[model samples]
Target: MSASTRSPKLRVATYNIRKSIGTDRRRRPERVLAVLRELDADVVAVQEVDRRFGDRSTALPPEVIAEETGYMPVRFGIRPESLGWHGNMLLVRRDTEVMSTQRIELPALEPRGAVLADLRVGGTAVRVIGMHLGLLGLWRKRQARAVLMCLEALEDPLPTVMMGDLNEWVMDGGCLKLFARHHHVAAPGPSFHSRRPMAALDRIITSLDLRVEAAGVHLSPKSRVASDHLPVWADIVPAGPTAAAERHHVAQSPLI
Candidate 1:
């Protein structure tokens, strides 16, 4: 395909917003939105969007996210009123078409879960999973294995992206090794402890079918103080002819 006809780059991000609480220990959803606007990702996997106890209602409610950043939160959680389960949330650009969504029940020492959203980006089907793994080394490995098992059970083999705070402070080894065997585990630089950032705990792993063009941590004045963990983003291009055709179709469609 010609350069002009090629599909535009798709930006994906994963952020552990710490429930919109900043380093100063203040809950500020507006600050979170400001950081997100600066990231400007097409799809974002967010962790800690809701409270851990009680009704589990949203900290950054869906309506607010929609109104502020023009992003639609993928609906999936045990609690109907909650934005996400285990504090994991996924958001897509308003233009994205969400085909289906579900929750992945993982066996862990603690209450751990994941959210999956099958979406159409430029009309190309892509499955995205947002999760927060367990803390223990053994549980973390089990959680990662369970996630891989869930992917293997899918009927169709579509391009998939797995993202969230893995909680793996050590970047080289640990549970991530299992994913590295099959997928491209992205290291978007250090994103943990938003104050003195040193660990690459947050990650964006992609299937072999997708092409990763760029990946990095979003460090800005607003992002630095928005939460305890910085946001990470990736620029990707869907592979194969279908992605190209769909992109052309989307581009040709009239603007609203």
Candidate 2:
């Protein structure tokens, strides 16, 4: 697909797997993988990944997920606790090259954090950040603040694409504003309380600098039982340098 000067077309999504347990008293790997395949995201930020339980890392989470869905694992950051490796992960198309990646530990009741990955996709630099915040109210408030701090601390002002299981439920909340300054695209809809979704809890917001080429909430019958909350996502086409320069010229040049 040809990318325009303003935005490069891409498909991305976020999903929160509820520990892979579904209606069947079993963690059906096929079902889990199937749900993801349906979403069809070129890049994804997944939360609640179980790496190791009692001395064994999930032998093939990356490989299996990749093999089934074709999205390659770029980076995985396990939580501080060692018993079971529970944490966040970023996956991209196998063809995509990883430029850099890191874990961002935030202040909260639990050891919550985020993963910021710099990737080169088809000759374009895409900054992808995947984060899961605290569930508790007080802890979540603090965690939200910390999330804003991460955006403020970015090394470059280039357009950013963030995803993951952001624990916030309120649509008009302050956290949205923090992302707003960066130009998050309009939310597709809410994606929480999946058993019987009440409010649009799960969200897919993006930097205003990017365009919402496509967006949606995943709520398959299996996805609901797999996780308490549904996964929301957005396909973003970042504002390229050509567009940025034009905007700068508009800012500096007077009306003719």
Assess every candidate by TM-score. 0.89, 0.80
Error of 1 at 232 (Å): 0.2
Each model's lDDT comes to: 0.84, 0.64
For model 2, what is the C-alpha lDDT against the true structure?
0.64
* Best prediction by lDDT: 1
Residue range 124-173, candidate 1, lDDT tens digits: 57889999988888888888988888887777667789999999987867
Span of 10 residues, lowest total lDDT, candidate 2: 77-86
Query: How many clashes in each candidate?
Result: 0, 6
Enumerate residue pairs that collide in model 2.
51-58, 183-207, 183-208, 184-206, 184-208, 190-200
